[model samples]
Target: DVAKGYILYLEDISVSFDGFKAINELNLYIKEGELRCIIGPNGAGKTTMMDIITGKTRPDQGSAWFGQNINLLELSEPEIAQAGIGRKFQKPTVFEQLSVFANLELSMAGEKGVWTTLTATLTGEQRDRIDNVLVKIGLIEHRYQDAGSLSHGQKQWLEIGMLLMQNPKLLLVDEPVAGMTHQEMDRTGELLTSLAGEHSIVLVEHDMDFVRSLAKQVTVLHQGSVLAEGSMAQVQADPRVVEVYLGE
Candidate 1:
């Protein structure tokens, strides 16, 4: 039976690469509008799990669903993205030469040819949307600036703002605060937490302090499967997690 409140479901999923099981019978779920943090040591199958969800990799056994009726396994990568799933890798990939406002403009949902995108004019509503996202990402003042000149953290936020322009239902973020200063990390945490009620977020990070700052549920992955799921404190207290990850 399909679950009622979940925005994502990964059940009994497994994938192997060259005979090594990367994700083995992993089960994970995200409730609508919830922010979930995933953490694990290296080789813990975290990336593969994200791959499965985003349609970049298919599992050998089990199912992945986006919503009540959307079968994720049957969709192409672009199709999945069109269906409202967005992913941001650890590295920021904004258009360096373009202005921040222009970057968000090009990222808005729709099929646009290069010629059309270059010449198109924005409607009042569209401009408002971009402004809204700019505010959300704390980049309104930097809107007219070249993306290349922004700091590391600002680039990451701009990229996230670009994703928001597409109005995704779920976002998968990979190590967003890896190189951020403590202040930037705090800002990022605030931005992400603010987005949770409108869009479900699955954040994969190794920064335990940043994860704890979010104060959300945390999932610990080990050996290609979920080892622990609870609050940050709860998982830290979990002997299994400490032995495998935290203690190291």
Candidate 2:
């Protein structure tokens, strides 16, 4: 049966690397259409948790589900992606040589070979989809430019546009605003907040000010488990969170 109003579920998830627990019996739940921010100190198992969800890493013990029916543990990385999970790493990875338009075209949901997909004529609906994503990512004006020619922040937005092309149900974004200018950071925050209700976003970031700008529910991880979860104000006031993370 489906877990009503939830998009993801992780229970008793644990993994070890060379006898060091990277994830220790972690449990998390993501509500449908929710925008959740995850923050943590280094080695706090944040990446590991995302890897587990995307099938990039396997755990020694746990159950993960997409919605209520899809068993994430039984799927491969590509399978998980095809099942509607999209991940964007800290670094922007647009096709530098390709036009912004072409990059999004290449990322469209399909099973066709890349060459065939690129060469095939796009239906009117497909073209409209690309246009819509360009507007959403704030790159409509740069659609014809080579991805490499865009500034760092624009490149990040383009990469996000690429993911939007696939229409994923859940998105795992890691440090999206790293190395961005303050203006870019604000724009990025606006973009992410706008997308929240339509797509469940799990954002893992280290920028306190950026995180505060989002003002969404926050989860703090430590020693392979969640140490704190609340509003930014509540967590910032947490003495344990301060002692282990903010205090440093």
Candidate 3:
């Protein structure tokens, strides 16, 4: 049996929009409990690749598989999400009017296909899980505070907390440190680093410093394909990477 140690596998994925190939023969893999970062210049198909993984855009060719048994290309977007793949966009989207606790509660997947008030009766397990996530997100003290009142970083954390409520096996985060203050970025880095061993995380970011702090493996994309992949030091040392970054 194959070890089944990989959380995600993309094999020669290619996507074309209006006859122009945005992603071409992209091959990538993320191991279980690993934190990987994807970096690329503009037009590198970074966003399109993410969309393909999340089922927003179907690839024109190749395969995307989750774990050993699941063929992701056959799943719908919501189905993919339900299969323990969580994605966070560059912008924070939280329930502004809802209190922080309420926001997290609404995100609980165990509640079935319906929306309920935070004060509604919840199973003991559900309540305990929410409480634990609140603590992990560092918002236990502000549980009752309105999410709208939180700082930018706090709102971002709240959104992440919401995603955490679903207990995803893999997290896809895009530009998490963008527009964040240095202090907030450091905290976010710590939070993501802590999540590595528990949840496989793939971070797409342009910030080299942030990637250095978070990535165990880094893949650089250019011209709709992987330009280089390795540790930050290894990729940075590649002449192709240097020429790509500095020559332009």
Candidate 4:
């Protein structure tokens, strides 16, 4: 797998906040189209690691690369995003008053100065892509509905759909299933599973059962660095992981 050309490569990344180290000598990688799950306890540097990857937080040392050619550390936050990395925070941030379709349309990665109305000259190819994403996100029927009218799970999906409009190469999603019912969680799991093979996904989630259902390669972080990496069963049986969960 070393030769598959990883979409993301982070080596020896370290970062500190104030007097405390939030990330220490972290090394992580995600192969093209791989679905990876990250699980960790509080203060485990999960968010900080994402911040580093997205250029929101600069690491004290080490390198972050989008591919062999691009030096992620050299790019600004907006530049990194423009380079095909999209991140979804824990909370949904859709335009409540806009229609679902409008929300997705506004999230287009190109020049926002182009004006949402009055025909920004989208290619037939681009329009087709938007139509397809709407179907994939299960929002086709709700296209005309105000985003505020969608349920929580639907809102989450809309936000994800908005991210998809950017056509990102890698998506960093945090706590996607939080505040959802079991049915919503299950559907969300299916959606994420469906996303694999087409995109590389790094998911940070807490629901063990949901993680098991997705069953992608799992990485567990502790004390600002990687503590364990394996399948669910393998990590669950690790003495360190078991002890940490039980002790906390």
Question: Can you tell me which runs of candidate 3 are displaced by over 4 Å?
Answer: 1-3, 111-119
Off by over 4 Å in 1: 246-248
All candidates: CA RMSD (Å) = 1.0, 1.2, 1.6, 1.9
Report clash pairs, candidate 2.
Answer: none
How does model 4 score by TM-score? 0.94
TM-score of each: 0.98, 0.97, 0.95, 0.94
The 0-to-1 C-alpha lDDT of every candidate, in the order given, reads 0.95, 0.94, 0.89, 0.89
Across 21-133, the per-residue lDDT of candidate 3 in tens digits comes to 89999998899989999998878888998999899999999988898888999999999999999999999999899899888888988745444544468878887998998
In terms of lDDT, the poorest run of 10 residues in model 1 is 109-118
lDDT of 4 by residue, 161-225 (tens): 99999988899999999999999998888888888778889999988998999878999999888
Q: What is the lDDT of candidate 3?
A: 0.89
Q: Give the CA lDDT, 0 to 100, for residue 149 in model 1.
A: 99
- Full ranking by TM-score: 1, 2, 3, 4
* Lowest lDDT block of 10, candidate 3: 111-120
Candidate 1 versus the native: TM-score?
0.98
Which candidate, 2 or 4, has the higher TM-score? 2
